[model samples]
Target chain A: MYSVEELVWNDSFINWVRYNKNSDFWESLRASDPAVEENIRKAALIVKAAAATPEIPVEESEAAEVWNRIRRDTAEPETGNRKWHWAVASVAAAFLVFLGIYNYGKTDTRVSYENLISEVASSDYKEIRNDGPDPVSVSLPDRSSVVLYQGSKIGYSLSGYNREKREVYFSGEGFFEVSKNPQKPFFVYSNELITKVLGTSFTIKAPENSEKIEVIVKSGKVEVITRKDPRKKKVLESKELEEGNYLVENQKIDLERATMKLSPIVKRELTELNHAVQQMKFDFDEEPVTRIIADLELAYNVRISYDKVKWQGTKLTAHLSDEPLYDKIEMICKAIEAEYEVRPDKIVIK
Target chain B: MTRLWRSFIAGDEDAFSEIYEAFFKILYRYGYHFAADHSLVKDAIQELFTDLWRLRSNLSDTTSVKFYLFRSLRRRLHTLAGGEDVYQALPLSENDLRGLQTDSREQYLIDKETEEIHLKQLGEGINKLTTRQREALRLKYYEGFTLSEAASIMNMNEQSVRNLIQRAIISLRSLLS
Candidate 1:
């Protein structure tokens, strides 16, 4: 049977659109056996149900720390990851000809980050190999679990997982579901990249003789860094693999071992634009115009300044769905017969 | 949410902040499932959104905000745990519940049996469940009373008894989630 993940992600399958060129492909296949449609429908519902799992409520206490972190991050825009990625990329691009040993260390933290990862990767660990046919599941001292694939080997602390750090040296493939301990950060050394996590689940596939290493996120965030640099003097220790990326669920990062380049594609990044809030139909039945505009501003995350007191009594019934923000504004303006001006950060209605 | 996300992607500072505010708790609920360590879950959640905001410009458009946050939080937690997805289901069956299923009591149904565990942890978890749910569960599951019997004993309606049982299930699931 076709895989569920692939089929759900396949828009053509979900939408059931068989165009002329590929028509013959599915046509001939289904022509031989017409009963295949049942499997397709069941797969669609299961995939849909996966997305429609009961809404889990996130507690207010749980959100407090995350709120602080995001605010602090976005608040300081200049020093963010994108800026670092760009600066390193541009430097790499500009001085590719002079790409020997250089001291581009002071300005960017990439240098220190690279060294930190290298230092972690080269640490001491006891090795366990899965030569047998069955997958070997290892329980760490701290209770984190590792399922080693056949022919793969992993190394961890020989003295049992030390309190300060939990490290794993892996080659081939493994699935990890690490127990949580905030003090000791978890590190997986796979190929040139080191996957670091505090407490989460993820998988790393580093097959022997393959040009690419794939790290797929099962859950939680992890920082991926390249152990890409060779030994240089104090001038520079190491360089980052194009700044780190945090891959979320249903996302995969493919790193070309040849170039030490990493690229991530998160499912959220490629969604079919499914917004639950936007799906709510808006039919203002003689409601205050301010209410309408307010809801719109809230939904669009835009600011709309208008004389609310004057328009408090104004009421109108209008239905709107799936229209562009500007178009929605235009319709509201036409109904209210109010003039509007588009400002840089907001809209002004008079 | 689409519009907010569009604005966030467009590098609107306010929209990004708003998104953070809107989805932080929801992400937390999804995250706690991976690890029982509350603080660790919180830190992972903080790091997830912080990274998301940092990579806001790079994020692709998404339709399902809940799934997006959920999936992101799961990935974040796993990365922190330094493992693959921890949300794997164990081969739990009614037999595995230590004969809780055959008791024909509603308490077994309420607890949604798992392997035997520590008493203190179970107490802490049971404490979080509501009194109504507990009463309903005990009367219906422990005492082997029918839904209506439990309701009449508790002086409540059958619908309320059903609702109580549902709330109990939800409460128990939240502990795991």
Candidate 2:
């Protein structure tokens, strides 16, 4: 018979119990010394409870942003000594200027061919995951952009077919802001469905272990088509989607309601306008809290507050990065000689 | 080994990211438990990973990459703490200072001291054994190597690995109790 302390600290016995789970020694030990074994089990329970609880330490997204900046800074220009093995001068630069001239009055309906070309990756594509509440930018050669959400993978052929029509595949979920180019449409193949859109913003997801492909548009229209389906014969009978707004491939089309908001014209207009605004850029030169808060409100069109109204006068003047909506608030508060607590929907200025 | 070595050495960013991602959490946990500073751990892990990437050409002779990483981390921790004093004393906050007058900070200090004592106890318990015995325990438990793998890694016989593990556990039990 062992004392409670003796049995609890028995490493071999504990290891045996930890690994085997239903070992006979535990039963025998419990029978011989109930109190000791009970303590051992209680201690195990404490360790197990601590292990089970997820303790995520919160750090500012500054680390991630810094890492990104480092990676970008290290690319090509910064590392002039190291010649880029796969680097090619992107035509997206020229395309941007062309679009600027072409879209003087009209909304640019053409997603830049340059943006489409940018998607032509040279490296072997593999699974990508972004496990944080921030947007991850992947530049396609055509200057089209993809923002992968928290847990998503975007796979594409980088070697054998890299220069071709930019064939890329995706699974899980992601948002795409395609550079407008009417000549070459951007294609995202997932599961059995293919989403083809020319110069538009949209999201597509084909979750693991699920058969359905979910396509949702935030800006421009997308045509979803079935690549391989038993119902292909039926689909071939008619041009299933004569610009019928939104669609689900291989699935029955509810021909009744096809909604179209923000026509191609309006979308072009908005993109041009947004692009110009993005160029103008916003800077706060180490301004006071009150001033920064006012600037942020004007920029993002959101209201901000401090723990005390008097705290507003506290000053902060730092060049703000293109941070997420909430992080900006946090930074503003931090600058102003105060801390801000985050609420579910808003920030509590403290 | 040569194939993976070549892939990594060729500046394959994906390969680097994959290896880094797999060991990142474990390294982070070990670093956090030892250094008690998050930023320091992050920096150490980054340095470790970059070194690993640079030294990929030598991977063929090195078996048990996980063991190598742990040993390196331990050495780094030892250097960071400096000399023999293991525990780091963190600064007290304004709230804690105020609580000291009310005896609350004293209570917290007591609890923290107790936790530090247990952590030291655990470390010392493992340290009591011979190098072989300690290696066996570390490989089997922390690194999750099988008995045969541990034997292979330690370049010892299988029975020797088992015997060493058993002896190490018994010694730790005595020390811990």
Candidate 3:
């Protein structure tokens, strides 16, 4: 129940009217909420009239020229930046004939790198959707593999990963095994959450029609942030991801569907290792408690506070690979009869 | 918006073309409003797209595509203008004037508003608005940007944008009447 002005001035509704998008839903709304019909009609007319055309917005020849110029500039192998670089290089060569440090102010790749990330992202997307009961498998630009559950779809740009970060749009559940690239992070935008990782594997289940989005990290760490502002409420919004709540591996984050509140990251009780980390095994042969603590610390990137001298000769034989790192620690504590406390960043064993 | 930008950066030719075509007119008109120079506007837009393509691979994410393009166009126009005074040029040429009128809809709207008096009143009402108000109206209504996006383009806060748009709409409606 929006006022006439609000309805007409609404960006998405205007787009809907112009494009006839989501027609059925709007029609049903109008049918149910009859009072807004007159307003809807008036707003539609106003938008239509305002968007009216007398001539092409841009002349064809002019558009052609712009396109032509774009083609020329983008297609050119030896462009202005290169020439400038060469000119600077020659000037340096002539000025400092003697061998000297010449690389200080010679950053020439920056312009091209900037150009690469911005324009290279454009293109038709390769969409992988799973409609049948079976899950669908797809590979990403960074050699990451995704298994989309039934009723799920993922669309990603065709460009292979290079310097740019990898991203994907997922609706419904998707299991991803992303390749490692510390420099370039990979991102997943689900219902109300943006999951970011340098390189890791995880499973995100966000049903298309549902508000709830669950992100569970299997291996490596990921930052899942909820992007919802309580002030700005809209029925449907097609928006880029926002940042806020963060979650890591051996953790699960659930975005409240109704409220769009990002719950805190809870420890992963059932840690499912993805393909990348599946090969890593925590097999040990009567390894000392101190040594085992060190290995576990390295494996999960957590600090373990323990008396190396007291547990120097205490040996334990166990393959606690299947369980999560926390669970493994719990089992080890139980076996060795050691009291332990879990701090935010470290495990203290006494 | 980030996805589109990323694709363009990743050397997706199609994305580049779509972004160019989709934004060209809006950027063109936006630049036109400031300088009233068609060629200048065109060059500014072309340069903007060119620079964007060049730097696509490294551009950060944006929340709104419309806002991002307008912001870029403004920056490009500023650089292209090089401190040259604008708006004194005033009034577009006959050929350039028609550039803003969309095809098919132009005839329809003119026919709908066949009365010269109504057209005059509409024009006068639009002229009555301050430059900022007019720009805000255009960005909000014609360009179909949300208040936030318009605010970003205008370099104003959201509350200011909302007030400007609301005031503009009210004044225009009153003046037209």
For this target, which candidate reaches the highest TM-score against the unseen true structure? 3
Worst 10 residues of 1 chain A by lDDT: A89-98
Error of 1 at B158 (Å): 73
Q: Each prediction's DockQ?
A: 0.12, 0.02, 0.11
For each candidate, give its TM-score against the true structure. 0.27, 0.33, 0.38
Instruction: Report every candidate's CA lDDT.
Output: 0.52, 0.46, 0.57
Residue-wise C-alpha lDDT for candidate 1, range A1-350, written one tens digit per residue: 54433443354553332122354554454345434543343333322222222234465554554564555555652334322211211100000000112222232213222233344434554677877544545556666655566667677656545556777777766556565555677777665666767665554555554556655553466556566533212112122212344565545565665556666554422221122122233456887897788666544445676765578889988875433455567789999999888654357788
Give the root-mean-square deviation of each candidate in angstroms: 27.2, 23.6, 25.9
Query: Residue A158 in model 3: shift from native, Å?
Result: 43
| Candidates in descending DockQ order | 1, 3, 2
If ranked by TM-score, best first, what sequence of candidates would result? 3, 2, 1
Residue A236 lDDT, candidate 2, scale 0-100: 31
For model 3, the DockQ equals 0.11
Cα distance off (Å), candidate 1, residue A349: 70
Task: List residue ranges in candidate 2 displaced over 4 A.
Answer: A1-94, A98-350, B1-12, B60-62, B77-177
